[model samples]
Target: MIYYFSGTGNSLHVARQFADRLCEQLSPIVNPVLTHDKSIGLVFPVYSWGIPSVVDNFIRRFFQSAEVRSETPPAYVYALMTCGDDVGYADRVLDNALLSASGRKFDAVFSVQMPNTYVCLPGFDVDSDELCKAKLNRVQARVSEIAELVAARRKDVRRLKRGIFPFAKTYVVRPLFNRFLVTDKYFHVDASKCVSCGRCRKSCPVGNILLIPTTGGQGAEVKEVPKWMSHCSGCLACYHSCPHHAINFGNMTAAKGQYSIMKQLHG
Candidate 1:
């Protein structure tokens, strides 16, 4: 089985390609969630140099549960992750999770670079179409190499040691990061350009942003909206999916470009 978690489509796209290569069942960890203890593979994006909190919690619970024991344990497993930068100990996070659960080890691990769309965070930049295409090609090559290694039973794996930063970020830096940095970058509704159509609010997956009545309440509402940041996945789905293009990622992101992987696998 292949287990995947994705806020945007980057990791999902990779997982889908991996499933196609292996001819295995693909299961999502979120959005119609499922549980699996059988021989498995994990695919996701590296968030803050480690697994996302939701994914970590899922593994912690999966191993601690009694139902997982009756199934065939994973004799061979692999981990694949995509990141905007070098993956620092992200594979170790997954390795440790599996190790704690059943002493199972990863047969192979891989990381690839995808376009960074999480404009909600500081220093995050949107990739141009040209850059995205080039990186996607590189990632596809690496992924294909990983698939070959999996088929060959090459057990060249590394231990995850960069736990200090991940732990500190997950426990300490994350709270402040969410509280301070998560606003005004994910999606911004342009009041002057917006027609109060509620297109952006409806398009938001997390519903953190909504349309509210203006002070005068003339047509509908212009700018009064909730600023909840905890629920955001930084996918930019709201920004791209909006019909009016009124939703943006602020001025710095106004000129920023975007890209996506349409083909399941690249040749």
Candidate 2:
């Protein structure tokens, strides 16, 4: 069984392809089903140089709530983490979480580079069309290789991209990033540009968006606009999926680019 968490469709796309190659069932990390399957896999994006809060919470709940099948847990547990660049010890963080929850660490872990979609901060933006295409092209082979390794049930295997200052990036900066930046309070919509299309609400994976009604003027027609609840997974799907580029994370995203898996495949 493979469980996944995705936003902007990158991890989901990878998870679907990985599952197909291995002939394994795929499920969301949220609302995870209890499984007696021998091999359990996790596919998700590495956010803020670590696992996203949503993924972390899912690990806590899903592993802690389930009863162990035996003295040892699943025979082989693996993880495939997608990222814009490097994962910076995110695999270690995940292993730590799994160890705490189930007293077992990942047997195999891998990270693959994907198109950049983390554009909510300065010095971070979406990749160029050429780079995006390159990353997407490279990912297929990497995922296939990972799937093959997982199928073989490789143990003690760790293939990660831990960039400069890995310790500082994961331990110090990640906590700060998740604490401050991984939030929905910074999100808002440009009502004029929104057009009340409900695209943002539909794209949100966590159902954190609501379409609220508002009037244009006195006695004017009321239209529903996107409003964000505070339960965001920090995936930026709403921002990247908007056709009109109407969504913004505070004022930081106005000049940033948007990219999604569907856009790469079809756009």
Candidate 3:
């Protein structure tokens, strides 16, 4: 089985491609319950030079569950991360996290460079259409190579060489990001532009978005507005998937472009 956690369809696209090539079932990591015995593949995007908090929690829970411990571990475990650039020591971090959680490690690790979707901060912006298309083409070729390796059950560890800066970034900055940066307090929806579409609520993997009727008096027709809860994963699904571009993370994302690999390729 291939389990994936995606915010803007980059990892999901990779997961689907892998599933097709391997003839495996594709499962979302949302509230996953692992009961059957089979080789496992995890696909997700890198966040803040580390795994997304949602994926981290899911991995920890899945490995520590009694259902997984009651039987032999998966015959082979592999991980594929999608990133705008390099995954700085994320492969080691994942291996270590798995080993610490369940005394098991990924047999193989890989990464694919996709269009950058993390534009909620300064110094970051979505790639231009031409560049994004080029990157997608490259990702397709890389995924094909990854599928070949996975089919052969290759046990190679593909990680970027780490130095002092990379180590500090991954170990120090990553923890800070998980602790302080993953929240929905800064998200806002423009009332004028919002169409009361529940796409944001549905796109949130953590159910952090709530659609509540706008408060008013005197024959004011009911209209829903999205309110973000505190338990956001900072995956940017609601921001990127908003059909009307009504959602914004503070002032950073208002003018930024939104990207979804599936939409870019198919629509």
Candidate 4:
């Protein structure tokens, strides 16, 4: 089985491609409750040079559970991370997390470069059409190579080159990102642009967004607005999936454009 966590369809696109090539089933990491024993593969996007908090929590909980502890580890295990540039020591972090939880390590780990989706931050923006297409083509070729190796059950461990900067970025910067940067408090919908469409709430993987009716004057027609809960994963799904570009993360995301792999592929 291939378990995946995707915010704006990058990782999900990769996971589906892998699943098709390997003849495997695809499972979402959201609220994962595994009971069967089979070869396992994980596909997720890199967040802050590390795994997403939701993926980390899910791995910890799933592996440490009584159900998993009662059985032997899978025969083969692999992980593939999608990132805009590179995943600095993310593989190491994921291996350590798995070892800490289930006392097992991934047999293979790899990365694929995808268009950057973390647009709320300054100096980051969605790729242009030419760049995005180039990236998609390159990643598709890379995924094919990876799928062949995985189908053969071969071991391929790709790690970041040993360096102080990469180490500090992954170990020190990642923790700070998870602790301070991952929150839903700043997310709000533009009332004028919003169409009462539930796309934001539907796209959120963790169900952190709610459509609440506005308290207008008496006999006024009510419209629902998105209210973000406290349990956001900072995945940017609600922001990128909005049809009218209605969702905003403070002032930063309003000017930045939206992107989704599915939309790009279909369009």
Name the best candidate (by lDDT): 2
Q: State the lDDT of candidate 3 residue by residue for 150-239, as single tens digits.
A: 888887667442435778779888888777667788899887678898989998877888999884466766789899988888889899
Query: Which residue pairs in model 1 clash with each other?
Result: 39-74
* lDDT accuracy of residue 82 in candidate 3: 90
Residue ranges of candidate 1 with Cα displaced over 4 Å: 32-37, 70-75, 99-107, 153-156, 159-188, 191-216, 220-230, 243-245, 248-267
Across 1-267, the per-residue lDDT of candidate 4 in tens digits comes to 888999888899899988998888888899664746567889999988889888888778877887666665455778989988778888888988899998888888888888889887789889987777888888778889898888888865663323356778798988988887799988888776788989999999889988998845777667898999899989999999899998888888878978988767767
Candidate 1's residue-wise lDDT over 1-267, tens digit each? 787876557888788877787777888765524556345677877776666655666676665566664566434667787777656666767677867875665677788688766564456666766677777777666767777776665686642324346556555665575466555444556666656656456645456575675543566544553343556655466665454556666565565444335532251
lDDT of 2 by residue, 123-172 (tens): 99999988989988887899888888888888999988888988899999
Residue 103 miss distance in model 4 (angstroms): 1.6
Evaluation by TM-score, superior candidate among 2 and 4: 2
Let me know the TM-score candidate 1 reaches against the reference structure: 0.70
User: What's each prediction's TM-score?
Assistant: 0.70, 0.96, 0.91, 0.91
TM-score ranking from best to worst? 2, 4, 3, 1
For model 2, what is the alpha-carbon lDDT of residue 249?
A: 90
lDDT of model 2 at position 82: 92
Candidate 2 Cα misplacement greater than 4 A, ranges: 69-73
Question: What are the lDDT figures for the candidates, one per model?
Answer: 0.63, 0.87, 0.83, 0.84
